[model samples]
Target chain A: MTPPEPVETRTTTPAAGRSAQTATLAEIAREAGVSAPTVSKVLNGRADVAPATRSRVEELLRAHGYRRRRAEASRSPLIDLVFHELESAWALEVIRGVENVARGAGLSVVLSESAGRLTPGRTWADQVAARRPHGVILVLSGLDESQRALLTSRSIPFVVMDPAGDPGVDVPSIGATNWQGGLAATRHLIELGHTRIGAITGPSRMMCSRARVDGYRAALETAGLPVDPALIATGDFHHEAGYRQGLELLRRPDRPTAVFALNDLQALGLYEAARELGLRIPEDLSVVGFDDLPVARWVGPPLTSVRQPLTEMAEAAARLVLDLGREEAPVATRVELATSLVVRSSTAPPPA
Target chain B: MTPPEPVETRTTTPAAGRSAQTATLAEIAREAGVSAPTVSKVLNGRADVAPATRSRVEELLRAHGYRRRRAEASRSPLIDLVFHELESAWALEVIRGVENVARGAGLSVVLSESAGRLTPGRTWADQVAARRPHGVILVLSGLDESQRALLTSRSIPFVVMDPAGDPGVDVPSIGATNWQGGLAATRHLIELGHTRIGAITGPSRMMCSRARVDGYRAALETAGLPVDPALIATGDFHHEAGYRQGLELLRRPDRPTAVFALNDLQALGLYEAARELGLRIPEDLSVVGFDDLPVARWVGPPLTSVRQPLTEMAEAAARLVLDLGREEAPVATRVELATSLVVRSSTAPPPA
Candidate 1:
């Protein structure tokens, strides 16, 4: 796509039949009896100027049609990183990735979340807009039409990370190959000579969850195995949810000998549930998980799971947004990174 | 203070001196021979307007200085949450607290960190200014005068958490009673019948570290015990740092019977170092920690540490910044919260 021409300095000239030209910084300075530099500094939200002078300049800027341009320039290097609030355990890794890239690029990042039941007035959109950050990185569920329109109209650039639903808008995105990772996880279980494999998935509304489910099915089908619908349980991608679902799956009349959870947190839950039921990790029920977070190593019989390149993804996202901000060109791009399977003591062949 | 008089409408009319009052929706509609309601909807960032008409209106607004107020209001609600680059195990808890409140407040937060070493053209200050956030929440340390000056000039309302040095400028702040917490921790060790207590602290440049040192000295004085300068060692507040310091203290000719660490991560390091030296906690040596983070529970013998109200502190910081953003506000405010001691298995009487 062609880059838009560089924006010219704002003008205040008026043609015939038009009212007087819109006010300029020079005009506001004249009205406030201050130097143009002082007016510019105040409008940019500089704090060093005397409070009285700052207030007077702000009043004049509001009264006139003067637009503050320098502040926009100074504030564009910062990006707002948005996520859905859950346990911070997993989110921390993602944050580490984003922070590394942003800092490396001389960019500042701010974090926010849209967790808990949705509420009006105090929505994530309101908080982010109130801050007026340069670009936004949303790790969230779907956005309604109104919310999408709100961002588009404001000309704010954004990139979505691990979205829960179809992003709907055409924007740059970065995510892992969830489907591929899921298939690899299932294949690992199959190689362990486990035919009865159960699965715990994230909220089905999320795209990554759906992809993982597809991967599971594809793996079973490829191996000429009949997929049992009863073996699949959905969770909220949380430890508690994983525990609940693990218990329910284990209680089934024909319980599977192996289980694959969509995330490490859920796998941890499954571990607790298994322990409660007098089951040993690999001896009784082999369990596998995704997202090899830090906790994976510390748990008893360390977790066998798929590890997403969280830090790399974060760095890529930060770079993508900074690139978008530096150039006036608009480009829609999606970068899908790879994942690897980490084999630990959590998985073993079914007890003979 | 008395409340200001309530105006019928918060919106102020454009002063008469401004060019033709920059034709607004109503005036534009009158000139375009269209209804004011239609013009209003179009200017309000509504996508329902036909593309042809939308472009027409945009062009007209650009020409007539018809500023689109709603356009700015509709942007994403994301905020930037900044931090220093050093990675710590306990930082997760602090981040969780920030995310929890920000999500509850309906804001999305982005995470960014300053690189450890200051480099030309790629400073955290530049990143912050470029982001143009509505406000900033800085977790910074060891900022030089130039960096501080840049932030000050931005006039962005920011709240500093665990700042390294005296900000010198007026800004909202929320800090734990580090000095008091330190005293309490050291005092606990003293009360446990340990006369010779060693201490490990973070970088001395940090205010928290300095306060903790002061507390350690005060506790010894209050107990009528002589303070030993040889017993104090400084670490970088890392597990490895703690380990190195622990080894050093253990080798001292007059090694103390007990040790107090300024933070949990440091304490964990002490645990490791002791284990390597075949010393058992509370048997051969007693140890106490600060910041009762989640990992504090998982350690072999759960850690007895000081618990600071991190979540409350984050919420208070958010409130402070929001208050600053209001139309009218007080000069500035400072808040100090308390911490408590949690008795776990890590600490006991010095060995007989």
Candidate 2:
């Protein structure tokens, strides 16, 4: 575990230190002009309560920084796993990891998709509250303020795996060393005698994506090579994007002899682009990919890629969330598993 | 929807027709020499019940063909999705389909893996009984008699998707037309003027695998070509199996010019084998696959494949199980969705 980098607010302590942690449900109910049972009903996410009353209770709970005392029996023997979208093999790896931990803990996993929404909807939060799962693990997804407050008030723990965006300083998360992976990938190509190397990047909003591109830049700078803006292409981390971007890069009169794709799918797409253009891999064009997905190995000529420990990262996130639910004291707030480069036939010395 | 197929025992009727459906928990308690509350606890999967007493109650419940009365409020807002093993992109497609229906129904999906067992463990059954999901969707997995009885006694309906084995006449299942897909794939190769063709078979015990191989034989026999047993190889529907089995077939003195690999993974494995043997796809050897996974399009030379509609079948299975839980009348006992062939660049006329 990495040393804890202090998050601004790890517990239900009042912003001004007014001992809000001591507030009781009955006290909050009185403050909200509702009965104790009504407050409890709102806490349980029952729909019978009036919206106004529920809002009042929620506001008071937040203002007081109220945290429900843990009652193990009240929580279902389940853990919740939410995803930004369930689209790729990348997601399956994470799901298997969390499922592994959940099975070992005698808990089933409740899966949900935000359907491309970065924040899971209000309905999803309500469902989580009603179910009272041991904890929630979100992959490449984040919680909005209200959603975070709701989980906090219910004492339901959550951890983010590879946050797509900045998850805020207070959020606990698990991630791979994307920057390091990118650096190693670029260095490998550089070592193979390629100077005019093109790069394809994932969406800029993602921290991991940004970090990797930055690493690429760092590698070029450290090796006294010029970084050309014209050689870089942006993609959405999908195969189609890779193909479209790869074609744009390759059709250029000054096309580089090598390219680094942000992920395995993109690399495969690049392979397709190269094939369509009558280019031979490692002979006319060199390529490197990230994620080292299973397909990377099965592709023609095989792919050289940076391996992110997706399953391990997911297992760590699951364990951290569960531990957060049980431990009175805070555990590690953020952890990054190491990423390594796997060299294969996809890369070779540039053609003379 | 497909026409209704008769299932011998679709409901809770005693073998001797002694009106077991009318047997109450109180009567079951009396028969098992346990209190009514004890029987209720057993039905709820409480851990506190004595093992001997629980077994006695379970035996009585089965002997009487007991089925619990439905109580909507008692059912959790979850649907269980159990897999024979969560090993491939195929599972992700199914998960997305079930998640789509579950979200629309305002429910979440609880996922479990039988960990390669055809039958899920006893603990999984107990957990399902305890959580009481809206329904259970078992992918390539089945329930034993006692496990089925346990779910029946708890009023939890289940549907199988692409059952690996015969899921019994009484079990509701959803599947694709695997045999037809195999026939179409083989016929396409035959039309390309290939006199000799090779076939890769998945495990024989799985009905889907058996149907596929049978379809291959049908295609060859119908085309008036002598079927060569040596050209047919056995694989386990995995990349490694395809590679190993493919090597043996390709190394023969008179190897077939074209091969139908049972699934996409195996086809990719075959691709690797061809590459290793200095063979060019569509030129040296033609290949076709089943399950048309996304990788089919991205692999070099784009694999020709049979599309199984995995997600659609999963959605249908989910909808069917939910319908079974609500409808008083029996719905379709089994349904087979259609499969089609997607010919890509992997297949071509044999060498001139």
Candidate 3:
């Protein structure tokens, strides 16, 4: 195998630092001190571009290394999107967002899971290389060193969406404000006069889950409550995990009057657990969930949730991936969308 | 614009009938009176293939036109999986199944939608051709005459999964026993002593929706009950549509004691309509749904549903696409997986 080629952030080349922000065609033209169409002509090798101007633009192109159309007349207009799993609405929302952008660009989106694993297997990269897509998008996933080099070697730009882990300082990513979402969810319960609140955090290994837990802790500290390790329970972000951990939390002699689940699925599990325990929602135990998936609104009494702007996050991620694929494209190394509270019938003042 | 070439199936060329069924290298080898590996050597242009055997194999290859690997070692290994839309758990299940097979075959699955349209848009075929994937699988979708001809012309065999329209005599497809699913759902209700039953169906344009409704009517007739046109309401297979139509049926003083919904989302909408009207599931009314989606088991009273075997159908579709991409694959023009009834808490004998 070839020695790992030093990729974008590893080198001091102009293109390496271009990940700071995304630039447009006009910006590339202005930087090269030429008209936008002239730069376009040079990029497309139209012969009308002055040789001197062409060389100047060419140097800028290498420096910026923006997305260059491989072939305008006949190009494979497909982008590869890889996910850790496609078993939930979260993946669908991302697909919808990517499709919106891809359709407008006259491009097609091709989806793949990371081969039944949390990360793209080595073979996954090889298949991606085979497809030779214009770019790649990894959702809730990360790439190993070799996989990163493989994609980079082939010049296939990729964007990380809701990355499960820290994808490094160089990898461009789109995520929601998880910390704020957790904070808002906790504050809502506090505003409803609940102090002894329990929390169900998703798997700690995931960055978003950890961020939410941190936000919850921050809110409790701001309210002058000691952070209770006992009140924080761990879950895998699935309904069964929620039910199992929710039971552990609810059965306590000092059970909280309110609880915050890291995700809607877990909160739903709590609902079943509550029912099993004969607990009436809000009146006996208030609940708040995150992600605000469609089911949140239809559940009995509905659910109070932290809306993560999943669709918008996905759309932004799609845009980011498209931008990254452009030659001389300014790259935003990271982007985060806003998350807000969606209050519904699932929460209220603690029992008087 | 390039003139459309009259494609396979339209011509008497050997490649035309090749769409009849994909044959494998082994089959081609047998027909050519050579060993499988020897035939492979001929296709791969290995020097060892005897000249006489090579010519014979090549002739057989043209006759069968089995999946011709364009430079096997360097060929793009991506398979295209297109969807009408990706908004539901139904799509996710299919994705999961496709990924499972694609992984094992050392191929990656690329997903595309019909350019944000319900019908596979005209440009969709062009995009697939540009990618030149190993094969194509369409979920709950069909290709127009021109689209089919274009794919056939390019030797890009495609299999339709759960085709929404008649795929015709030439096109290969995979589908569930929708009529059987509907029959089972209705029979379950009837077995519970429901004579005054109603049905909510998906859009009539969808073949599955029509077959399901036909099954419902068949079940009612089998039980010696008149099928009331008033009780059969139209829906778009969505929650709001189900709620609106459910409300329409429930408002009648002669409302059904048991209602069969074509899908889980619509069934959930009926749950809401019942709640809004101060009714209870399996008490004031009984509900049966199709597509045992994950939400089916988690609802207030777990929904009794007709299992469409979406995952299995998807897996089968994935396998079919791979087979069509092989050298001498046996062609199965259409494949239908079985559908069965899943009894849960939502269905009970009609309240007296």
- Candidate No. with top DockQ: 2
Q: What local lDDT does model 3 show for residue B123?
A: 61
Per-residue lDDT of candidate 2, residues A220-250 (tens digit): 9999999999999999899999999999999
Error of 3 at B289 (Å): 0.8
Please give, for residues A236-334, the per-residue lDDT of candidate 1 as tens digits.
778787789999999888899999999887888888788778888889999888988766754556689999887788777777766655544434468
CA lDDT of B294 in candidate 1? Answer: 62
lDDT-based ranking:
2, 3, 1
Ranking by DockQ: 2, 3, 1
lDDT tens digits by residue: candidate 2, B222-279: 9999899989898988899889888988888898899999999899999999999999
Evaluate residue A336 in candidate 2 and report its C-alpha lDDT on the 0 to 100 scale.
Answer: 93
Over the full model, what C-alpha lDDT does candidate 3 score relative to the true structure? 0.77
- Per-residue alpha-carbon lDDT of model 1 for B97-206, expressed as tens digits? 76666656655555665555422233445444433344566664435544444433333456777666675545467788999988998898888899999999888777
User: Model 2 misses residue B312 by how many Å?
Assistant: 0.7
Task: Sort by TM-score, best first.
Answer: 2, 3, 1
Tens digit of lDDT per residue, candidate 3, span B21-135?
4566677778888787676555433446677886687666656555443323323566788888776778888888988887788677777877445568756665665455678
Model 1 residue-pair collision total: 27
Report the CAPRI category for model 3.
acceptable
Q: Mind sharing the TM-score for model 3?
A: 0.81
The TM-score obtained for chain B by all candidates, in the order given, is 0.74, 0.94, 0.81
